[model samples]
Target: METDVLVVGAGPTGLALGIDLARRGVAALVVERAEALFPGSRGKGLQPRTMEVFDDLGVLDAIRTAGGLYPVGMLWQDGRRTGEYRMFDAVEPSEDAPYTEPWMVPQWRTQQILRARLEELGGKVAFGREVVGLDQDEGGVRARFASGEVVTARYAVAADGGRSTVRRLLGIGMTGEAVDPYPTLVADVRISGLDRDNWHIFPPGGAGDDYLAICPLPGTEDFQLVARFPEATAPDLSLEGVRKVVAARSHLAPESVTELRWASDFRPRAALADRFRSGRVFLAGDAAHVHSPAGGQGLNTSVQDAYNLGWKLGAVLRDGADAALLGSYDEERRPVAADMLGLSTRVHRGETRRGEATRQLGLGYRDSPLTRETRTHPGPLRAGDRAPDARVAGIRLFDAFRGPHWTLLALGDVEAPEPDGRTRLVRGPAPGTYGPGLYLVRPDGYVGWAGDTPAGLPDYLARFGRR
Candidate 1:
């Protein structure tokens, strides 16, 4: 088989990338070793910035429909409710930032939505294709599957989780530390006595005992159960084992856990790939960095990785941009991944709270080579900052930024370059988030260049093949 890009592992990262490439008319295929989609409620929180990415990917409405906001956390003592508190710091939605809180959706459901969108855009995924060997040359990549079939593509991405086969085949090394000495068991199960309105938490009964948490998954009847065990001890994944742990940790009976749908155990660890790129292959998601799940940054960061790489791949493969433009993917995302890794580790260790930082709206590529800040005195939103959403000239800014295209916001008499095949212009009065200036918004929704006029905009656009 031959394709423009070969995406390894049909997890959220691979599927999201496939969707982005497909919408841009790039030929790509997502291949997964598993026979079907992942079935679990893990990685359930969608941070606010990720919601914005979903909006642009044309899956926000379906995501919102399939999921709901997180419930207030309810503490329990001796089977009686003690208190309730919000999980994240409360932030109200404003005109500039519409999504303030994280949304909750099972990881499985999220992948399903992304895959559907990919297919809607004429993309395809091949299941049970295990890439056993990968060979890359100056021109392209050649991959051999375990099934004795071979496929070739210009590029390949490793979204195959932490122990990525692709990353191993490329001999890339990972650096990290175990965040916690103990192991955590997370599962999706049906419970008999827990109310779905609150996330039930049971503190450890004794010094040696472990804590248990059962949070209801939105849009489903199952609750996600989490428990910790002593180091070097394997937490049982069997139904009886889950029941025993729940009964011992909480005040519930063994039978309260009616059914266990899926379960896995892992030691909380933090790791980052030494390099996100090797030859024609690039690593993304868990393959690039693995985070402790405390801040809910792992999956959100992974999806955004796809968002960042998608446009660069499209520009080079479809829009005739220079291949050197692809180098920015590693230069831009690796640092962000490292920062998120630290944030997740801090949140996991209880050294930090899930406040503004956990929302990830503050992440950007301010120091990236692609960002050009030309204004003498730029406003709060500068080059490489996320262009906030606002109502400008009777049209919503996000509405203007949607789709696979660059957006030029010519606010308050800043003349916009004539609209071209790949760029859209939004002319309006200056909104407070962005003081009057010419903002060149990248397809991924960051301010690529800002100037008082369109003085250097043409050169910057030309670098991205915006003719």
Candidate 2:
């Protein structure tokens, strides 16, 4: 095999997985159809959970430097305000919860950062090499590229976009209904005389009945304007069309807009693949699920998908762990995708706007066996929960709320157990401050089990560790 893992698509999901695999000394090769990284800002926001994953990759600082932080609040159809809700305000980080704020960065910039990190880890994305065809077998998979190149790998991850070539080759059906009233324009422009502090200027009935979402882009005078139009009323991508929409919706003159960087029409749709993995070939990101970009969860979920699968793939390839470990990827992530699909549908239907809990606190996995066995009540965040970030011992880091690895947090006078070379124990000030219990964090940064006894630690490790 040319590589241990072959990833199709150089977007966030594929790049993230490639970086993690490379960090773990796995031979990962990534391919992208585009000749150059996408320059346009597609998905321009990162959720709090995604930021935590970035922190774990040691690229959070770089992402922070490249991005801007904005406190998000909701604006109702009636024009009532729901005061700004900071991403970290609800869930305080402890030794358990780590990330605090959801950083808003353009998708293009985020991809650049991930690509740079992947290079630092000694892997590079093969751009313009699209996957034309792929065939999988019991031991390995063979992939053919558009550039007349072919390679084989022990496994392949299809991080490709919604219309995945790999998914088609695998004969996997995407089961879902299309959202009608198609064709909405998402344009990013530099407009004057608009309040930059707030988002969403709804016209009576919210997004469904002519509402506009104004997203402030840091370091630039531009803002992303996501406007949904009735299918029959949708206009062409022209200056006159833009002017017409803005005038009809906001009573603002089109001439006030100086520069229009990108303006394109897109339809809102939701879908989920019938399967996530087919033998050794797996589908992730948009390949597994897709939804409207209303809540900005597309890129975030894609990156998280990579984070969940990367370490598992690395461990399995390097440590010779059971193949069952890979099954957990589909088990854990599919539900999150389903939930996001539902959330995006609601957002598209204008049922609600993005809330604080939706942004930070509400996402978790209580169904996982790992969380069910060890947790009495959901820890700061539960399994399948979006991990929270908090300050601990004056050190700021992404907290481990998802279950995978054992996080030995030494609080107070309690000395940390001697290094077992496997567990990651974070020593903090004040003993017994972690609520009289020790935490065992999973690889995805959730608490798998917690207790004061040494027996709990061994059992937790034995359950998740390579047998």
Candidate 3:
């Protein structure tokens, strides 16, 4: 087989990249080792930024229909009832920024939606094609599969899971340490006497040397129970072992839980790849970084990584930009993954002192060259930052930003008018009605350049708009 881009692994990251490339009229192929889609609920929460990307992919509605909207407020450790730290309270959405509510959907359902979208775009994932080996040249990459099939592509992306064969073949080192030896079992089960609306966190006091978390599954009364057991006494994560842990943590009788949908034992670790790219091959998702699923950032971070790199790859393939443009993938996304690794490490250590500021507010890239031209306060989230989503005018604008066109959000009638051709100007009430800013949005929905006035338009177009 031959293609423009060969994406390994059919997880959220690879699927997202494939969809974006196909939408850009790029021919891409995705290969997965598994024979079919994996079932069960994993990574049960989508952050606000991730929801925005989903909206741009034009599948947030399907995700919402399959999953459900879950607005999770912060939980206090001492049993004090504090006010909700809603994501909407931090970043207000506008006509350009849509996708208000964060979603709570299983990873499988999310992949199903992405698969449907990719199929519609004339790209399909080839399952049961395990990449056994690969060889790369100055021009392209050739991959060998276990089933005696070989494929070549101009570039190959390794979105494979933590134990990525591509990463190993390329000899990329993963640098980080593992969390202290503690056994944790995550199970999807149906419990008769539990509230499904709230996430019940039982710290390590009342329960028998275990910490418990109960999260609701959409469209069903069942809950996903995550329990951390003492390393000394925790049994292997068998069906009976999962039932015993759930019963012990929830303080309910063993018979109260009827069916165990899925159960797995995962040890949390924090590691980042030494490098993200080599020659014509690149890495994203778990192949790039792996951390504890503390804040549920694994899938979301991987998906966003794909979003950040997909457009750049398409531009490089079609427009023949500097190969250096692809280098920005690591430079931009590595820090974000590093920060997530630090945050996940802290969460694993039971450090929850940092409030919403640390969790929601401390994520932005204001220093990148792409964002430096924007005039805004220097903080995690600024003018050039990935704008958060909120409810604006009752229509989700994030969905509107998904297409392959430059978005000019005319906030407050600035001195500069919209550029003619190849740009979509979304005009709304000027001044504070639209957050008192003008954004030159890239096709992928990231803030390419933003300013209070339109003075930065020329530089913005010169930097990202043209070849």
Candidate 4:
């Protein structure tokens, strides 16, 4: 195999997977059809859970610098401010959840940051290499590119977005519905006569008029504009067209629309592939599941998919784990994607608000076959739940958990395991979230197994080919 893993599409999912594999010393390749990284602001909102994921991936500091908090929504009518619209329920930061809110970074900037980090780790993305077809044998998978090149890898992943070429070639069917039939235009533009303090909202002027929104893209001189049109009406993509929409929908003049950086139209939809895996290949991100932009779940869920699969792929390729360990990826992630699809649809149709659930901190893998709850009685942070970050005796839990190793947090004399370089062992007093027990945090920051003693710990470690 030319590489251990072949990641298609250099969006957030593929870049994140590349970064994880590079850190684990796995030889991998990332290919993108586009000439450069995605130059759009489609998936701009990053949830608190994803912030934690980035923290572990070593990009949180740069991500924090590249974005700002989501501003409060401002309502307008007749060129006057009517009231304030809360885009998201505000939450305060705590010791367990330091990143309480979603950070607004343009998707383009996020991809650039991930690409830079990948290169820093000696991994690079080959742009303009489009995979046209793929075939896999017992040894490995071969991806045929449009440039008449065949790239082989032990395994391949499809992160090539919703209309994934890999998925289509593999004949995976996506079952979903159109969340909104109305055509919507999302664009990145530069406009004046608007304060950057709030996300400006222009409500429907007449009975059949459409609503428009202009949000100042943080850390840049761009404003993301979204306008909803009636059914069967196609949005105009020209600069004059965007200026007309701004003038008609808002109080700003046509010329106030200084620059139309990028614009695209789509009908909001929710979809999930029939299967997350096919032989030597697996699907991820938009290829596995497509979500509505409402509630900001699509991109966050996509990144989490990478976070879940990265470690498993690393275990099998670099750690000599059984290939059966890879089966859990489909089992664990498919259900989560199905649930998030519902959540995104609910948030899109106004059936639900962007509440705590949207933050994704409560998501877990309790039913996953890999999760083990050996303890008779469990605390609030149990097996299959997200391991809450805490500070025990001046040692930050997240700081200790920030690496490509399994962490065994043995609290209060739980017969700590023998030292091993593969898994880091640490002992401390149990915090409030975790009562008194042994907590095993997975590399992806989830509590994989919990017990009162180290009775079944060795077997569990051996199952994943860990020492």
State which candidate, 1 or 2, has the greater TM-score. Answer: 1
Give the alpha carbon lDDT tens digit for every residue of 232-269 in model 2.
77646776777666655664577866678778777778
Q: What TM-score goes with each of the models?
A: 0.99, 0.83, 0.85, 0.99
Q: Which residue pairs does candidate 1 place in steric collision?
A: none
Query: How well does candidate 2 score on lDDT at residue 367?
Result: 80
| lDDT sort, best first | 1, 4, 3, 2
Q: Cα RMSD for candidate 1? A: 0.8
lDDT of 1 by residue, 46-117 (tens): 999999999999999999999998999999989889998688877899998999999999999999999999
Q: List residue ranges in candidate 3 displaced over 4 A.
A: 69-102, 200-208, 232-234, 353-362, 372-383, 388-400, 410-421, 427-429, 433-438, 450-467
372-394: candidate 4 lDDT, tens digit per residue: 99988877788999999898767
Q: At residue 31, what lDDT does model 4 achieve?
A: 97
Clashes of 2: 29
Give the clashing residue pairs of candidate 4, or none. Answer: none
Q: Provide C-alpha RMSD values for all models, in order.
A: 0.8, 4.6, 4.5, 0.9
The 10-residue segment of model 2 with minimum total lDDT is 397-406
Q: Candidate 3 lDDT, tens digit per residue, 322-376? A: 6677877888888888887787678667675333423332356566655644555
